[model samples]
Target: TMYELVGKEMTDKWTPPWPFGKKPTILQLDELGMTDVPQAERVNDAIDDAKVETAVLQDILPDVGFGFGSGRAVGSNNWVIGGNTTKSGMPLLANDPHLGIQMPSIWYVVGLHCKPIDGSPPFDVTGFALSSSPGVIIGHNSHIAWGVTNVNPDVFDLYRIKVNPANPLQYEWNGAWRDIKVRQETINFGDGQSPVTIQVRETHLGPIINDNKVDKETGEIQGFNNKDPMALHWTALESGTILKAVTGLNEATNWEEFREALKYWDVPSQNFVYADVKGNVGYQTPGRIPIRAKHHSGLLPVPGWTNEFEWQGFIPFDKLPTVFNPKRGYVATANQAVVPLEYYDMLASELGEGENYAISQEWDYGYRGQRIIELLEKLAPHSIETLQVLQGDNKLISAEELIPYLGRLRFNEPELNEARDWLMKWDYQFDMDSPQAALYAEFWMQLANNLFGDQLPEQIKLEGWAREMWAAYLLMEQPNDTWWDDASTSDVVETRDDILVRSFREGYNNAVATLGNDRSRWRWGNLHTSTFVSNPLGRSGVSFIEKMVNRGPYPTSGCTGTVNNTRWTVHSGSFAVDHLPSMRMIVDLGDLTRSVAIHTTGQSGHPYSKHYDDMIELWRNIKYHPMLWTRAQVEAAAANKLILKPAN
Candidate 1:
């Protein structure tokens, strides 16, 4: 089916076939399930292969979805400009990590100060830290400040394990039958429920996460059937010195020390943007990215019996994408591709001639990254105030990319034409109060659904960011492409124009129906809103408990691809913002006292506490609290003090 749409060459190239024999038929796209077809697989000759490599990689890789419960896409924006481009003649670093919006919030804002003991460096860092973690995850010390955006490298892989049918506990590895490691894990439900114990099977590669499926109705485990099980080989499984890296970063004084600290940072790769008191700006992509065999692209499952698809080793930390004081004066990353094609080539030359050096194929579209760079270039001589405003930018680049196609379409109905004309004149900002934004949002969702919804089944259908980008690509570059034809309408072949006109009419009608016929009353804020939900309690479904735990359906701005990334899914047919900047932070290297930050919710976990929801309004209003650095500033602002003396 993919071959029919994108042709054999493009399909084969993008969604590479199973490296073993015939590809296995998968019933569902489960975590341990085999790859069926890449999500939103496409063929666009006009776009450079290097540019689309990440999207193609995403398509081919099995979509296990975000490990977190959220269906929203994971992305963030982080950039640092050199002193030359800053008004204060000091680097300015800004970061807003897009994550699930919650009540207590994922970030725990705290200032850690420790006097040097045993001739060790004093810990005087201040910024966001996880309650469970020991040190600040992202922040600055006396000498330097840094921020991070996820790299989303292809560090995980699935292998089709060949089990010896005769001996269920044995698997075929390198032509020899080897014993599969089995571990019994007992999950204890401490609330007086019976404990359940299950067997976890593991091959030499790693754990077989889907060794057994559970029956939904009975809540019973269904053991492996005739089908071969898949084992996960992820970098996270390896014992990493991540804590060591964190502590090293907390104490690091300069660029060289910061890099040395990152050497121990393995697993869950991130693009670390750096700025220091010395007026230096830098970036480093540090992770344990696996190097696959020459034949494997890390796209689909391969036979575990042979070493052909096995990872040779990890890409060395030094060779990973790194830049220091570049000629561009700034380095920005929004989960987009960090390196050029030549970087891979250089790796191939250094590490063996034919080894695959794909650091990762799963990267976000460059809309946010492109937008950040554009703003950096356009608004030179940056300051903390300007950088804070930049963090709240709500311009949707995807709308800009797709709206031109609407202009080219000639609609028959007068109402449709009026709507089309209105959209054509829009500035493509997803501002909360903009009526045009509401109309455009509806039209774009309908257009995407009309274009590809018919072709893709409900189970594997494209949604949200991926769907938006793919639809835009097809409309812009491949107008007459076969994907334009609606599979449901068999009588006549549909062209791009035909689909556009039909979708536009349907979208306009749907918008009017939902938002009332009076278009002026329609506001994007009415549809796009954020609810800060408390975990377990918020999901309890009891009205009173949910009301106490959950925070607002607050009017929000921005879409999936904006710098102020308020991500929502169109698959659910609701514009309720799910993923957003969990925390916004701007570190003014010029003045550490001027640094400011705010999370979606508040610092306290207690719902009744005034500090619990205090930050919500400030966050919604794009305001931030000062990251007080000096002891005098901290004492001056302190309302209450609980000093802890050494218990002797």
Candidate 2:
């Protein structure tokens, strides 16, 4: 059987890819001291013997040639508010993590409304969980609300192991022989009801990925690289970190409680943005950060089997760098660079090394993050309307610098004159009907793709920068009846002027092909689609792999009139942020908390449910469904509610 069939089932029958150095097998209940051996094997063996082909997931990537466009369709953003800045004088928080716009979409929405002990007296929280988990992993608890963005910080490490030629599962940990921890788990192999068992191994460094076997030629283990820069991470499984965060969250009576709650966090690193009913606000760079030797950097993997590169200790939470309710009246996080380059010294001084407190390397803090900071800095007397505007802002100034260089082009037989004039009168905006905006966005993206083609030749394969300029330009320009009868990207092969024509040809071609030739055929909503599929825990498996896209654009407004989910385009980027928001309970936390969250898809994890796809239209239209938190709220939520009492 193929190793690819592993982990296809969600049962007590399996174990995770462990890093604790303990790999075990799926023991049949009968063999584990159960009295009924025959009955146990009957249920288990039937699943193990089903013959099925393992060719479904052999490719390294499902789609290789077409690079992601629409400018970072796969990133997330967040911002939090503390009590010191709220009208209610209580803290309030909000966040929206952008990610690769997947088909069976990654985020799931749910709400918890019952009263907890004596907390927030019947208040409710509406938020999402990462599909597999049951509780609201990110949401407003009761007294406060929190949002998270993938830290995307580098946190794991892989060690290149010297394998014993005879025993592949064993590798050298430190000048000595050490066997990787091995564990086996059963999975559904697709044919009939049969399941199969697969072995998993973890070395001193991490799990054996790739083919579950070392490559004979490179001697390298595949997968998350048990020897790469990320294998060393175990934050997700760290009990201290997970328990501390959860217990702390349970006691959070206000913003301060929330801060203490974050102290026990581990795994799936995040940027904590918070706000409470008390008008308090705060931000925490949450996660277990390893205190490594000053000589080592988390940017990439380091050598293992040696003492040189190792985690020194863990960082402390009290000293973790965070921004409390600043008198400035606003705080936001977008997984962007929190500290600007120029302000590095200032950040260092105000926040101390606090390295003993864990930091994350899941995502590097950079550009888009910093841009969000800069955007927030420009707000005046911040209002919900202003925050909404910020989410969907599509004004790219870089286009102005490149358009003039195109020299001569013809449209309407104006022979470069009308074309130039059209561009000259243009303001770079992706307004739905704006032709100049569309053409400019596309052209700018094209010119950029044309310029940087051969920079990184060997290491990686990614879409070039020049292509981005072309993509940004497409929003403004569309073809017309004149000098060019829709120039197909497939036709151009020469430099427009010392520029790499081939790359732009490809980038331009991609943009042209996916979106139509010119203005008349171009539509941002058409290209910016969202998919919602159901994987049924791990049982149904990732939605037939082929039925990935169940829905398309939902009258979304991104790229121009809106950059994020606005009142009109909530589906593409929005989520519910507060209960009793926008009406009676407006705490005046400015517009930050009341941003009225949304997503391009729905709340159900079930792919076939009508409610699963119902939210799309509401999201596209910038509308919201009342988040039910109490019994009355839930009852109102269900036009059809069914209560099933357990049979005695």
The number of the candidate with the highest TM-score is: 1
Residue 322 in candidate 2, Cα distance off native in Å: 1.0
lDDT of 2 by residue, 212-232 (tens): 445679954443233322233
210-327: candidate 1 lDDT, tens digit per residue: 6667788997888763375778798877798888989999999999999999999886788899999989998888879888776676755668888888899998888777878876
> How do the predictions measure up, each by TM-score?
0.90, 0.65
What clash count goes with each model?
0, 107
Worst 10 residues of 1 by lDDT: 18-27
Q: Which residue window of length 10 is worst by lDDT in model 2?
A: 577-586
Runs in model 1 lying further than 4 Å from the true structure: 1-73, 188-193, 216-219
lDDT of 2: 0.43
